[model samples]
Target: MTAPRASIGALSSAEFLPQRVSLLYRLSGNDVPAILLTSAIAAFALWGYISDKLLAAWLIWLVLASLVRFVLKRAYRLRQPGPEAAARWEGFFCLASAFVGTAWGVTVMLLYPEHGQFHEILLPFLIGSVAMGLPPALAPSPKSFACLIVPIFTPLIGLLFTQGGAFNTSAGILILVFSAVLLALYLSSNRALIETLRFGRENERLLEQVKEAKDRLDLALQAANILIWDWDARRTNVFLGGNWAIILRVGKETSALNLDELAQMVHPDDLPKVKQALDNCLNGGESEYVAEHRVKTLAGGWVWSLSRGRVVERDAGGRALRVTGVNVDIDDRKRAEVELLAAVQREKELSEMKSKFVSTASHEFRTPLATMLSSAELLEHYSESLSPAEKANLLQTIQGGAKRMSEMIDDVLTLGRAESGVLKLNLGPANLRELCSTVVSEFRIAQGKQHVITLDDRFDRPDVIMDERLLRHILNNLLSNAVKYSPPGSEVTFSVSRRNEQAAIEIQDRGIGIPLEDQPRMFESFHRASNVENRPGTGLGLAIVKKAVELHGGEISLTSAVGSGTRFTVMIPLRPVKQPAGVS
Candidate 1:
């Protein structure tokens, strides 16, 4: 068996061997026509000089050799061998080449004339032409080229030298020199072909690897919900990729849009800032463009996105030519931040409310405590010397102060329950007219001639299902505030009416009304109007009333001016009672 052929450059890497073998087969297949033509011409040239039988046999042998090469080429195409079988195929090719070379070499010995000068010259010349034409076709495999040239030239040169004449000797020397030159040319051509094939295979592999890497990067970007974009500043167009369709709720056909088209999808409120940031980067005022803004989605909603980019390419004049960037979904993060800020503000406001409660409670308790103490001391020291009227007056004053303190304490506790979220509705049936009448009578008795409190019961359906306890709290505080804030003998109207399915309770008092600026926060815990100067009260009444109203699934609103008095309207939904429970 022939020794396994050495791989190209001694680099026996499996990848290189298969490629070299394939190129050898391709070059050989292309030379089939040239091989047949050359053999026919050489046979015809020598037909006249040799005996007919000898010439015919030589021609038949050459035809058989060429047929063997054609069969090998056909077999290689059908088998399609891998790298491991490369050497086997190459050896077969070299063997076929050696057979063809031997047929050519036999031409000189078979056709040479002993005394004919023309036949001698013609035989060598025909053999030399065939030998020189082979390097280009056989260059893919140096071993194959060697196999062909050695056999073809050896016979002709040996016959010339052994003739022992000056002409014969000179002819043999020149053939030897020509064979050496052809061998040199074959080696050089083979090296160049192998190098080119190796480089081409390397390039194909690199390109495949790059394509795979890009596919992986695209998948990663899609998973992360990141949108990549490229801006061609000169063309004023933007190309979007990487999850853009899913994130923007758009179609793939619209992936590329002009700058104006892209801007149209931006939120109008946020567009200016976005444009400024991009312009700054393009103008070289900033190294990178970054902005958090709202982008309008195809569904007609806005999404918050954090866009970041930089000028990737620029012209010689420093104008941006291309910008590359990515957009990350930040809608959820922005919402959380907004909620956090509101919570912080609420906490701060609660802190301030606590401080105000402490200060106001201290001052309110002092006045009532002083009144009770002074009244008690006067009765204790002057009971024996005082008349019954004087003694009764002192006792009454002490009782009044104690009642005021109890009311203040109740208001604070009610407000506390509302703030803690522990206040619940106790639903029951009650009479709207009677409840209003009761609250008005109580206020009338409490303030004798200071204010005239009137009740107008316009609600025909007075019986309704509600949280009566909360309703009482609502009415009592509103009426009490009306009577307390109004001037002496001012008319305070308490009107109860039914508006559709709701009970509307309006209490209008001609009093020192809330200031416009302070009205918005009037129901806040421990918050009082700025105009209520020297008013003897804790600021918890209206706050407690507001909370009670809310628990009853109702709303309370006020209309007020600085000197024209305030009107408070409480609208509570009239939920019907299905079962008998309790009455407030």
Candidate 2:
């Protein structure tokens, strides 16, 4: 064959052939029709010069060759699907086309037409018309199309030029132009067909890759037991992945679910909060929604789930149209986080209490130690020179300073026991009336006999089970504060009563009252009222009292106003449950 036209805008044969192979075999059906039609039309015209037997023989050969090409195409489709085998079939198809076209062209001279007009004009026009239509069947392989074209026209056009006349020469040149136009069209169509097939093949490869990736994603999700979900907000419908069945406590088969049905799986107590968070994200112009909530599991129990999502599609009015998110099983992580946070908070509290203890202890200890040092020095240096009463007064001052230091140490030890949760109690029968009386007497001495410390006990059998040492610490700190914080001559009343099998102790002081804001945290360790800075305190008294009461299995509540005196009521069960069950 003459050199095939340069393939413009076409894939390399290696890439194109594999995709174009089956299509080339399919073209065999179209080629047979065109060959038979052309042979039949040419036979009628050729009868003018050729004998009927010869003409019929040529037509029969074309028909049989066309039939054989069909059989080869079928076998190629079945056994020769690979590109190398398909390449051989393409060569055979092109050769068959060229052989038939050459046979038809040579007959113009071999038969030597006697009807001159039929040979010159009608015959050439018929051949050119049939050649132009060959591209549809053979265009994918441009070489095969060109093989059919040149064989039909080259000899006929050459014959026209050989005839010595202007009509003959011009007709020959016109035929050449027609052939050029036909070749250009064949090249264009061939280029388009190859490019189209390549594009389709590439598209199929991409689709397969996407399918494989989707399968991998599903496998990963299933392995992790993660549920992937998409919520169409406008439709209120949810599309869940296959793994959703693992978490959904339902039958084997499930139907479509709406947003409300999904929300129903959330714990009832947490559902309102979950809905609020979702509403805030969807309606409050926030694109993201995240929450850790308990979702009912397949066992009808709750598991903590962390759901995270964002509005991926929205309407122009800023409404959520679609939400995409994942529900990751976060039960273990959530429990761990809660425990860690509690531990961290406890550590923080201990740090603050220790810091306040260091600062307050240093200040409180320094004052009493300094006072005792001064009193001891005065007695040692001036005892002989001073009057008997002067020596006696200094001795009392030393005793008082030492007593205050002892009380501060006791409070500190009590606090340490409470913090370490190893507080030991000695339970016994104790008289509430005598307990109040004794605590008041200590208060009377500490306030220099000026403040009126009175006891009002309204109990018949005032005996109760309690640890007397903790009870004493509780009473001592309250009475000391009552005397220390109040002005001289203010009455501090201690009241004890029994009712409903619970003993209640009330300490009423006319001291500078606690502020409302400070009341909440007043019992917290290292917490002293903003108004109590002028007083000498370790900031541990109230904290120790609350711990002591809690150990006694009771609760404490306080009511106070700034500048008005504070009243503290402590209640204890008549029968305290020491080492209560589930306490640890």
Looking at candidate 2, the ten consecutive residues that score lowest on lDDT are: 1-10
TM-score of each: 0.63, 0.51
Model 2: how far residue 549 lies from native, Å: 2.0
Tens digits of per-residue lDDT for model 2, 1-584: 23343333334454576556567678766667776787678777667665564466567756765776687678776785566676776787778778866876676546544335544545454544456356666776755676667777788778877765776787778778877877777777777887787788889999999989988987887677577778886565788765566654444535357877777888989888788888888885566798878877666888887788888887999888888888777777878999999999989987987888888888888898898899898888888898989888888888998898998887778788898997877788786678778777766776676799878878666466888888998898788878788888888888888878888888898889998889999888778889876777777889999998998887777788877798999988888545558876
Q: What is the C-alpha lDDT of each candidate?
A: 0.80, 0.76
TM-score winner: 1
Off by over 4 Å in 2: 1-225, 230-236, 242-255, 259-325, 379-384, 445-449, 576-584
The parts of candidate 1 lying over 4 Å away from their true place are 1-216, 222-225, 248-254, 379-387, 579-584
Give me candidate 2's TM-score against the actual structure: 0.51
